[model samples]
Target: MFTGLIETIGTIENYDDSKDGVVITITDCSPILEDVHLGDSISTNGVCLTVIEFDEQRTKFKVGVAPETLRKTNLGNLTTTSNVNLERAVTSDVRLGGHVVQGHVDTIATIVDKKPDGEAISYTFELRDKEFINYIVHKGFIAIDGTSLTITSVDDSKAQFSIMLISYSQSKVILAQKKIGDTVNIEVDLTGKLIEKQIESNLRQQMNNEESQLNKLISSIVERKVKELMK
Candidate 1:
């Protein structure tokens, strides 16, 4: 699991899409790659990717993106020079600076609006998969492009949500550099999803139990009516 706090911004050195598959090489990651190993997981643009290879200098690393992951995230939109938010998996000793981020992007969202809010900047994104909007809420936590942020407002009708980034965050993550039409990987709050699932399961079980009890009552009534008719 991750905390969604970006450690550094890594630049895409190479984006190779060969017949074998897509392999991305990210450079300028020395800040987070100091203790990197072959199997270490990195949150790149809000997607958990394993380190397939790394340079001896610890400045660059490569990861292979699966086909399904490409479809579900905005990673496919990255080019040779794209910048991505980078974060290492959290350890037990580290504080939970941000909410728990699994680096499992549910879908992609398009930047619909951008405006200056004093020293901060506000961005509004329209979700591509509108169904996921149910998971977003006002003042809820969200991970956009691997950077944890709080939702300032939500518009269900437009399938959009807004977030404000302070000047400090603007310099740390790639979101501030993106254009209005650019897309970013989105991971809604995990706790909300879990709660919704649990509620649905409980309601379903309750309905089943009620149906069984009703069936037993009907059977009992039929038996009593048949006995009276025979008498």
Candidate 2:
């Protein structure tokens, strides 16, 4: 799990594609690779990827992504010079500064607009996938491109929030690279998703049972009226 607090921004040195899958090599300022092994997992642009290789001197790590992951995320559009968000997995000793982020991006969203709202900046993003909006709530926590944020306002298809970004966050987090028309990977709060699904399932089941009872009552009423008319 991740706290949605971005630790560093990684530069995509190279992206190689083959019939099997895509391999991405990224360089980060975080000494994340110092102890990183070949099988370690890293959050890249909000998507969890396994480290296939790394070099100590370059502070670089390589990860292989399947076609499905590339299709679901903006990784497919990444090139050699693309900037990607980077965050290492949470350890037991670290404080949970932000909300829980699984680094499993549900889908990608596009930036609609951004403007200066005093010192903090308020940005709006258009929800591309219809199902993604169901889990979003006003004042809820969300991770956009690996930066955890609280949703100040949210609608059926849009989310807006003003982020109080510090100098370190602005420089190291992916928020600095945002543009008006850029696409970003989105991951909703895993806890919220589970709770919403449970509520929906219960509501649907209750509605179905109520409908059955209503139909039976209506049928009984009609039968009684027919008997009365016959008499």
Candidate 3:
């Protein structure tokens, strides 16, 4: 699990595609990689990638991206020198700065608008998967390119939402590298997902109970009718 707080921005060094998947190498820009071990999970552009190799002295690490992951996220389009948001998996000791993020990209969203909002910048993104809009709410948390942000507004009819980025965040992360029409990997709040599942389960149980009660009532009425006929 992750907190969606971006630690640093890493530059893509190489991306090698093979029959199995794509092997990505990124230049480590944050100290988080200092204690990283093999098999450590890293969030790159909001996609959880396992560390296959690391070069501490050179400040680099490699991750293998499967074809399915490539198809689901914008990671496949990355090239050398491309900057991406990076975050290490949260430890049990650290404070949860951001909302729970799975580093699982739900869908790719396109930036439809970018404008200044007072001292901050606001970005409007349109999602291709309209069904996912149900998971997004105004003022809810969402992760874009691994950076957790609160939704300022949501347009369900257009399948678009806006997020406000303060000047500090804009300077810290790689959002400055993006512009209108660019695609970004998106991860909705994990808590919302869990709540949705729980609600669905409860609804299913209630429906089952209602069905059982109706069946029992029907059986009781049939028994009374049969008794009357016998008398």
Candidate 4:
């Protein structure tokens, strides 16, 4: 698991695609690669990739991207010289500066707009799949390109949400350098999705005995959860 905190930005040195799968070599990551191992997992652009090979100097590392990951994330769009957000798995002793992130990409979103907001910059992203908008809430946590950020607002009409990056964060992560039409991998709050799944399962089990009561119960639970998140 990860805390969704980006440690550094690593440039894609090489992107080799073959009939077997995709292997990417990332350079300029000597800091985090110091204690790395062969099987260690690194959060690359918010998608967990296992370290398959590394050089003795530790300046660069290689990881293989699965087909499923390529289909679900923006990693497939990356090429040589692309910069990606990088974070190592959190240790038990470290403080979780960001929310829990599984390094699992839920979906990819496009940067629809970006504008200056005081010393900070605000970005608005439109989800490629509208169905996932249900997981997005105002003030809720969302990890974009492995950087944890709070949702400033949500627009159901456009299937979009906004986030603000302080000046300090802008210098630290790769998201600030992206263009308006560029796509970024997104991972929503895990807690919210878990809660929704549990409630949904419970409602489904009670559907046979009391359909009307189950519907009311599900509605009440959803409404209460929404209120709690908004607060």
Residues 90-160, candidate 1: write the lDDT tens digits. Answer: 98898999999999999999999999999999999999999999999999999999999999999999999
Off by over 4 Å in 2: 56-58, 157-168, 201-231
Q: Which stretches of candidate 1 lie over 4 Å from their true place?
A: 211-231
TM-score of each: 0.90, 0.83, 0.89, 0.90
lDDT of 3 by residue, 170-222 (tens): 88788867899999999988778899999899867766785666566877899
- Candidate 2, residue 120: Cα displacement in angstroms equals 1.8
Mind sharing the TM-score for model 1? 0.90
Clashing pairs in 4: none
> In angstroms, how far off is 151's CA in candidate 1?
0.6
Report lDDT (CA) for all predictions: 0.93, 0.79, 0.89, 0.93
Off by over 4 Å in 4: 210-231
Which candidate would rank higher by lDDT, 1 or 3?
1
User: CA lDDT of 8 in candidate 2?
Assistant: 72
